[model samples]
Target: MNAGLNDLQAMHLRRLLEGGLPLDARPYRRLAEQVGASEAQVLEQIQRWQDEGLFRRVGLVLKHRALGFRANAMLVLDIPDAQVDEVGRRLGQAAGVNLCYQRPRRLPQWPYNLFCMVHGREREQVCQLIAALLAANGLDEVPHQLLFSTRAFKQCGGRYAPPPAKEVANG
Candidate 1:
């Protein structure tokens, strides 16, 4: 359990993530000024939070789609319930399989339980990789489907404000 942060520190933490880190040589110093703390104090609090697992990581998340990953697909697998975990683990370790997860298998009509993502230079290449995975996993007999991404409407960080209506009206 993390030690409870006072309201001010909590607000500062949210602002830091939502607005992003300062683009300066010494971001800690800049952030300290913005949040009304010494750089050393800010560093100490952040380090403590990290040590306590309150925050997992603080780093850049590159936009893969914007970086020429034009072809992307979500591959769903219909593995036996008993084998889903093993199959998911194997698929997750495979190169090009960026995301692998397990979802409930809808019976009768739907059977896919394992899902994985593949992003590549071309749709053909992504399909080939999926075929290879099915073969390597001895899942040629299993049912599956590949759902390719058609469009991306919005992609951004988490919500920081308490909802525009509430915040604006209260302010």
Candidate 2:
């Protein structure tokens, strides 16, 4: 409903999402049932939304801290423009480096562009792995920061509601 979706369509999607997907093999089918559509209809709409760049991702979010991977470190690298994509790919592919991406650099204050999240049972282990990754990738000369989260924050799925149809037409 935030962008490409109309009010009714987004409402249906939100209705299904708010209840969370069923764990069965036919989860989409179940979603369709709850949202008043067929399985294929739901799939096609979701695919169309994705193709239109409505959202970057749609998937499950795990609670790593509850799973014993307590140490969560966000590693930001000041990688050169030429190396950012390559380094981000490598980091994303590496074990324990779950999240990796390249963001715009903020000049005169922050210069980091490549970012990754590494998790481990212990903080020291996470640090050691980062060192290993830097050495292995020959990124020792690159400036970086490893910011370990001191506490867990409230985590939840995004919430949204579609605007009235009249507003959509008038605006």
Candidate 1, residues 52-171, lDDT tens digits: the string is 886655666557788988788999888888888888999999988987999997788888889998898789999999999899989888989999998877665665544223344554
Error of 2 at 44 (Å): 4.7
Error of 2 at 65 (Å): 0.8
Supply the TM-score for candidate 1: 0.75
Runs of candidate 1 exceeding 4 Å displacement: 1-5, 18-24, 55-59, 157-171
TM-score of 2: 0.73
Count of clashing residue pairs in every prediction? 0, 0
Best by TM-score: 1
lDDT (Cα, 0-100) at 39 in candidate 2: 74
Question: How would you encode candidate 2's per-residue C-alpha lDDT over 1-171 as one tens digit per residue?
Answer: 323445576577765664467898999888777666777777777788689997577777778889998889999999989878878888899887888999999997999999999989999999999999989989888999999988987655565655334644555
Error of 2 at 155 (Å): 3.5
**82, model 1: CA deviation in Å?**
2.0
lDDT of each: 0.80, 0.81
Q: Which ten residues in a row have the lowest lDDT in candidate 1?
A: 159-168
